[model samples]
Structures are given as C-alpha cells and as structure tokens.
Target: MSSQETEVLVVGAGQAGVAMSQHLTERGIPHLVLERDRIAERWRTGRWDSLVANGPAWHDRFPGLEFDDVEPNAFAPKERVADYFEAYAKKYNAPIRTGVEVTSVRRKDGESGFRVETSDGTVNARYVVAATGPFQKPVIPAVVPDTQGLAQIHSSAYHNPQQLPDGAVLVVGAGSSGVQIAEELQRSGRQVFLSVGPHDRPPRQYRGKDFCWWLGVLGKWEMAAPPKGAEHVTIAVSGANGGHTVDFRALAAAGITLVGRTNSFNNGTMHFASDLGRNIAAGDANYLSVLDEADLYIARNGLDFPEEPEARVLGDNPACVTKPLLELDLGAAGVTSIVWATGFAVDYSWLQVDDAIDAEGRPRHQRGVSTEPGIYFLGLPWQSRRGSSFIWGVWHDAGYVADQITIQRGYAAHVADVPLRQAATSAQSHTELSERIAVTQGA
Candidate 1:
C-alpha cells in the first residue's frame, strides 16, 4: 500500500536485530528494523511457561544494557527476558516497526539495493540483514505425520504439561527443550518417555560455579563451533535454568523412560534405533571432555577460583540403563501426546538472491559478513564465534555487521576500529586491562 527507503533493513527485532539497531542508531545510520511480531516474539511465544534463561542474567546481558536492577544470578524467566527486549527497543526508541512481516527479500535488478516486501509496505535498502532467527520453524520427523490418534505437539506450542491429554507423553528429542519439557511433564505426574539422541550433558554447576561462569572466564565462549559430528548439539548451555545438571541420568532417575533415537512412526507404531546406551555413553564422555577443557583453561590462566565437591556423573544413575527400543506401539502405550522437541529449522526460502546462499543453504558469510555486497545475517549460532546466538554474543556481531553497512555507505566510522572479539583476543587488550586494573589499585 505504501513504500519506504532506507540505507539498511533489519528483519526480526529479537536480540540480534535490536543489538544491530543499537549500533546503527549510535552511528546516525538510516535503518529500519521490521518485526513480524513483537520484540522477542520467539521468547514470548515459543518457549514453555516455566522456561527461564539457561544462563545467569549477568552473563546474558546485551552490551550497554547489562542486567541492571535485575538479579544478576537469577535465571530470568521467559516474560522477564521478553520484557527486557521490549524495554531495550523502547529505551533507545529503536527504529523498529512491529507486526510487519516481510514476505520476500529479493535483489533489485539494475539497482544495487534489495526490495523487501512486507505486510505493511515495500522497502528498498542498500543493506538487508536476515536476522529473523536461529529458531524459526520447528522440525518434526516426516514419520510424525503418521501419528494418527495421538495428540502431537511440538515444544514450541507446548506451554505446560496440563495442555496435553492426560496420559503418558513421549518427548521426541533429547536436546535442552526436550529434556526440560520432559522433566516438567514427568514432574506434572505424566509418564514422559524421552526419545534420546546425541546430547551434551554438561554439569550445570562445575567446580562450585555456574557452567556459564567457567565458559566466560575460560574464554570457552569464544570457541563457537558445533561439537564435531554432533552439529545437533547446539551451543546451548546445559540446564533449563542457570542451576543444576540436567542429563539423561538425571531425567531417567526422575522416573522417565529413556528410549533410543526415534526412527519413524508408521502404522500406529513409532520405531527407534537402539543407540540409547551408545548415545548416553557418548554424551557422558563429551561432558567430561568439556569439564576437562574448563579445568585446563582455569589452570592455564592462573585463576585462583575455589573448587567445590566433585560434580555428579550420569554413570552413577542406576536407572540410566540404556536398553535400545526398536518400536513403541503408541496405542499399546496409551500415549496421548508426542512432544516434538526436535529443534527448529532455518528457512531462507524468502531470501531471493542467487549466490547469496551457500551449499549448505546457509547465508554465505564469514562472521556475519555475507558474500553479497550488502547482504548480512545476524543472530545465527556461531555467526562470529561460539557465543553468537547468546545475548552477550549478539552485541559483538551487531557492531561488526552494522559497521560493515555504515562503512560501505561512506559514513564516518562510528564503530570502533577494533571489534569486541579482537579486543578480547588481542594481547594489547589484555595489557590495557592489566594496566587499568593496576592503575585503579594504585589510585
């Protein structure tokens, strides 16, 4: 119905888009951020009712907007976190248009910019950022369509255990969502049979510190790549809350049936591969490896952090006997619901540009910088490094991505010459920090 033009257009006003806008606004960059829903819509609607940030509020703060006035150690719930984003969008009065869904993003042939077709209007921008989300569409197995007579609900739509039919529930997937939801369901007195998969079962508290603290201090957050061969092991923290270890052992001990990975559901029967023992063992090994890495980092960095009692291991759980399940007769089990905790899928079907997408169907980019002249992506897991998808991680990427847009437009460098990661990684940065600390102590 109407038209608009801007130097840059950012899609999705979530953590990534808001962070990007924060930097762009500081530089006097002309940009418009469009959100199909409210800011942090995913957090508001997609997560469970009791969902809290898996990490501490202190570590999850966006740059310049640290967790002030909020409990630093408390794991902020979904509403609190969503409100934080809303407050952020309002604090700076970010140039965000909510409820504006972009239907298509295509290169403007003969023109250098892109044409963004939105529910409100069309926008022409020199730079287009695909910051929609890392968690977009929920990916359910194809065989799930054969789940006749069973109430099928993906974790995205699952708010509480009461919402499902009162009977045994099968949580399909062993990632954070699946584990957390299954825990909740079982706690709600529902028999939750968890379909196990390759998962990272790191301890929530390691050496008397939150796992995140170890990750932060050890610079483990900087290493942002999916676990080798387990790309499904997202760079997610271990717990549903910022406290306690959550593993198959823990879940299994809590009276939940731990089954093998789901193969398919056909003819009223759900089939599984007998990799339960193997997966559990592998997860346990990876967990130890992770702790060892953190331990190594602490020792090598000469940190004098105190250690607590030894953390518990899944091996000790007697209920964690991983016998493979080949088939689950949904009718026989009287399973009234199947919660698909099978993570989300990214869709770039709207990104209408050739050579812009990589062979893996991901935006061809290195550290948020796209292969295309003016196209960029933000909020991607591992966009810059391991922490890219996390709240703190977005700030670093937003600065870099915004600077790339502004600098190309011949705007004065409003962004810092040295990026956050570089500053953290550079020897000069360490020297500067040491000097500052020394001077402060001297003063």
Candidate 2:
C-alpha cells in the first residue's frame, strides 16, 4: 500500500480535528487530518433536520471567527454550523483528506512513531492526535425489545417529523435531543409521549439575556463536571422558536404526554418507573438553582440584570406526574414509532496503543495527554473542564494540546542531543591527553 509521512496525524476531521490542525499549523507543525467523511460530517448527517445549535452563535464559536450574517444571540442551524466549520477549515487550509478512514493506529515496530492503517493507505507519523470527539456510536437501550412493525431509530438518524410512520411516537430520554424531537413531533400534530428522566432544566433566556450569557458570566462553563451520581442529568435547553426554556409542565399542558423513565417493553406493554413526579421535581430544583445563583451573583457583583419572576415560577404539576401512568399499552396508544434519543456511546477500539485507554474504554489522559508518549486525545467531555466538549471550548483545548505537543517535541530534541554533547566532551579530553603524551616523549 502507499505510505505517507507526517509529523502529526489527526484522526477525524470534525471540529476537534480541524481545531487541532489550526493550532498545529500556527505552530508550524506539519500534520495531516484523516476523516471518514466530509468535514463536519456529524453536523451534516447525524442531527435531526430541525435541530439548531444549543448555544448562541457568539458563545459557541472559535476565536477570531464569527458566524457571518448570523445574529450573535440567535442559534445557527445545524447546516450553518457545518458550513462554518468547513469555511474555517478552508480559511486555515487545513490538510484534511476526506473519505479516508483510519482503521487502526498502533506503535511502529522498532521505531519512535505510529503506523496508521487507513482505507486509502498507511501513514507514519511521529505523533497521533485522536480528535474523534465523543458520540462515536449511537446507543439504544437494551430495554427496547425487538418488536416488529414499530419503526425505531436513534435521534441521530432522525430527519424530520414526516419521516416517521404516521402514528403516536414514544420518545425515550429527556435530554436535549429527546426533548427537542418530542416538542417537534408534538407541534407537528403527532401525539408525543416523552419519557421524562433525570435532566437539568436551564432556561434558554433569563433577564433579557441568553442562557449562555448567564453561564459565561457565572463562570459555569469553565466549572468541572457535575458531581458524581448526577452526571446523567443533561441540560434540557433548546434553541428552537428563537430559543426558549424547556418546561415539562408546559409541554404537558401543550398536549405532549409526559411519562416516567421507560423501564422495559415486555409482552406488548411498555413499563415505566414510578419516578415521574420525582424526576420533574428534580428538574424543577435544578432550574430554580440556576435562577437563584444568577440572582445571587447579580446582587454580589451589583449587576443590573433584572429578575424574571416567570422563570422562577413552578407551573402546575402535570397529571402524568401527579397520577403517574406506570404502564402503557403501545398498541392501544397507537404508538407506531419509537425515537430513541438515548445519546451515544464512546468507542476507541481502533486505538491499539498500550496504556492509553482505561478499563471502561475511556481515554486515559491528563488534560488530553495520554500515558503513552506521542499519543493524545481531544474533545472528550470534561477533558480539561466542562467546556472541553463544546464547540468553542474544543478550540481552546486543542490549543492546549498543541502546546503540550510542542513542549514534548522540545524535550525529545534535548534528550536526543545529550549523546552528541557527551561524545564531544570525551573527544576533547582524549585530544588533550594525546598532546600531553607527545610533550612527555619530546622532553
């Protein structure tokens, strides 16, 4: 097979890879980015048709580049986000090879580099940056039984509401994807049964400012991951309808059936955990906590942001939470489709480096530096901070990783020069000894 060489090989030409390339280019690092598909492929293909960015444009972009012709406060469409990344890559002239899939990456035998096996050819690189962001694989719960005739798809594959079979839909999971799809289906005049789960209900806007603005001012974006046991609680904020807060009660009032955690499907009956009320209560508490923190921060900093009373008010408990429906007959409800917005799984099976992956299949790294030299990871959730996985945040993290790579290179060069330095010193001592011997003979 054909072989190519580069100082660095960045796998996956999405935002993370492109960002890393930009930083590496700034450092004059000769790197090649390999992508299985087009640049920003996920944003182009893996999202629902109506999906918009979860954060506002101003807060979610890389440095020195702004969303052209898009309002700062407005959430750009997924297509626009993809276009932005493509434009950014073009502007920097990132060395990206499209449709090149790296099948495996391993240490080169008896060498100080890596051998990357790709579909097109083999690449030898001194350093490899695994820039494949999270969401490598879509995961559907095992609880989803194999039922014939019920069209089920992960949110990644979902396009528009019209794509599903004409019937009531059961959306499992209440994260951003689940909630957004549920809301869209409901608005499309389809009965949506949303399985409510543990989630944070942060308002889209507060006090005439976008929620992202609040998070930025509060320094919440830079905060570490949520405390253990609450890591599963995803933020339920959406950028649809010019952006708005996601309220379960309001959704219930709007005709979407709010259900508890989907437990299992057995014998044509869908069982749900009796935690609807508790789940809703938890989300409400999370919502209030943000508002309270914002209020406290405003007062402490003497900021003039006004209070939003409507945001703080907890609406009436939906009947689903009050008198919970523990079970639902899918057939009776005419539920012909199931959208598993259950999120994605992390898979790094292709990385064959030793001591680089943990037992749980997560990258073993310190702020993106792997235990194995010359190997690194990028765009992992909380890789350095909570913002590590975000769009703009990934850019910052990539710069840091690039800095680490530069430091490592300098160190390696210094170590490589040690033997030469020692050899020169030995030669000078031998020459002095020879001259002394000759002087002794002459005397």
Best by lDDT: 2
lDDT computed for candidate 1: 0.77
lDDT over C-alpha atoms for residue 302 of model 2: 94
Q: How many backbone clashes does candidate 1 have?
A: 1
Candidate 1 Cα errors over 4 Å, as ranges: 234-242, 297-304, 312-322, 358-361, 411-443
Residue lDDT tens for model 2, 1-443: 38998889999988999999999887666789999999999999989998899999998898878998789999999999999999999999999999989999999898788999999999999899999989899989877566557899999999999899999999999988999999999999999899988888887888888888888888888987677898777778899878889988888998999889999888778999999998989888888888888888888989887767877778679777799889999999999999998888889999998988989888989989999899999988888887786898899899889878766554454466445333222223434434433543454
User: Cα-based RMSD of the predictions, in order?
Assistant: 7.3, 8.8
Record all residue pairs in model 2 with backbone atoms less than 3 Å apart, i.e. clashing. Answer: none
Q: 335-420, model 1: which lDDT tens digit per residue?
A: 98999988777888888888778766777888887888788999888887877867888888888786666445432211366344
Pairs clashing within candidate 1: 224-386
In model 1, where is the ten-residue run with the lowest total lDDT? Answer: 420-429
Q: Can you give the TM-score per candidate against the true fold?
A: 0.87, 0.92
What is residue 233's positional error in candidate 1, in angstroms?
2.3
